[model samples]
Target: MTVAVFDHEGPWTEEEYLALGETSQRVELFDGSLHVTPAPTPRHQRISRKLGNILETAAESVGLELLEAVNVRLRPGRVPVPDLVVTAPVDLDDPYIEAADVRLVCEIISPGNAATDNVLKMHYYAAAGIEWYLLVEQTTGTLRLYQKRGRHYVEHQAVKRGGVLNLSAPVRATIHPEDLVP
Candidate 1:
């Protein structure tokens, strides 16, 4: 089910990328290239929901909003849909959330697209100046939090199942890795 719809013959424009995303499948544009990922597995959805709930509670305390699977425009030619994000109030009329407005971006690694979440997207989010990034490794049931330092992300916390992850930068919340794996 995971597939790439376009050949790397030419770079795609932001308009073109947005058009392609109109299809039923989920697609992300990174460095002018299109990457299509399969629908999330049940485990992926469950983990996302659990993390969203935890983030939601923290966001409520901080007066931010929690969004799931929303299109984030990191830049002109880069749009990555993060699994979950915490941001300031968004205007419904806007087409996509801007990177500057994002407080934290969370990606729950899909088995088929681990590299995209672990490496590519991490770099992109950092380059876009997103303050915080959370990566949940589905296979290992581990949670890794990264804070933007300079132009890249330096690992802040790495917690395995049964371990606790405490966040204080973007928001104040304590999450257990065991709660993230269903």
Candidate 2:
């Protein structure tokens, strides 16, 4: 079941909302509207899995931890679940993810949401002070990286499938396109 509350405006407190479990359900709260994305297609799942695996291996070697499809509460009223998130080492008692602690957030473009992923989500992450945002598209197997530049994001890199994903301010890891495509 999907729950949406629009009457009580303003962002919800992090502790009150982030208590949800990390299940298969993709949950997001956008612009006062709560949206639950449908279960990803098999193709989407394949890419998510492969990307997660590659990131996991890279993160493990570096003392960083990677999270998959987890609710990253940017603010009270804005929470987006990225395809993958790279974060600093979690404190023992803090299980929730906040924007300030995130090193990088990545979203894989799904049909009908490419514009939102590349534009709206880009604005949101940048405004929230997220240092790096990665947008990966399945259509062309392209990965776009954006670095925050004073309340906006400037195009950092756009790499095709065979190209490597280079990121600074988080961890240095190169992502091969074959690792993401099935």
Candidate 3:
């Protein structure tokens, strides 16, 4: 990736944003602006890792690839790094995964960025034509699965901590919301 300085400016073009070098903080591009978030907490990381493991195993059974913290170029001027993603195999040399290759994108909501994950990112993913979007709420350990329908996403299933989320679209898997918690 080409390295350019981030000036904390607004209305950045996709080219300008991608040219910026990687920073310690997590960064995303949305609506021509850069949104930077602090590093996740230990509890968040643990939940992400556990969910990734579960998804990876299920993806492997169906010949899909499960990726964690991968930069997905949903569209020009819109790049969001989801917590976990399931996709068809991508070229190893590619700088970012194309939205077309993505089957499912997930975000494990952080307490500090709940709105971004639950609302902003959800709309972005749906607009990108991603088939499935999974939202994991950290506070309550709830898993919500959304399926794309035309220009929006509809809630397909919702499971609480004690319930099981059995998904049949994009891939097949039985996931427990409680297992996702640290």
Alpha-carbon lDDT, every model: 0.88, 0.77, 0.87
Error of 1 at 100 (Å): 0.4
How does each model score on TM-score? Answer: 0.91, 0.82, 0.91
lDDT string for model 3 (37-90, tens) is 888888889988998888888898898999988789998878888999999989
- What tens digits encode model 1's per-residue C-alpha lDDT throughout 1-182? 85446644688888877665466667888887778777888899999999999999999898898999888999998999999999988885676899999999999988888888888899889999999999999889999999989999999999998889999968899999888896
Question: Which lDDT value does model 3 have at 45?
Answer: 91
Candidates, ranked, lDDT: 1, 3, 2
In model 2, residue pairs whose N, Cα or C atoms come closer than 3 Å (at least 3 residues apart or on different chains), thus clashing, are: 11-76, 11-77, 12-76
| Higher-ranked by lDDT: 1 or 2 | 1
Would you list the rank order by TM-score, best first? 3, 1, 2
| Local distance difference test, candidate 2 | 0.77
Give the per-residue lDDT of model 2 (tens digit) for 1-182.
95553334555454444555454567677755656567788878888888777777777778888888777768777888888888877763554578887888888899877887888888888888999888878878888888888889898999996788766557767787767866
Best model number under TM-score: 3
Which stretch of 10 consecutive residues in model 1 shows the poorest summed lDDT?
2-11
Which residue pairs overlap in candidate 1's backbone?
A: none
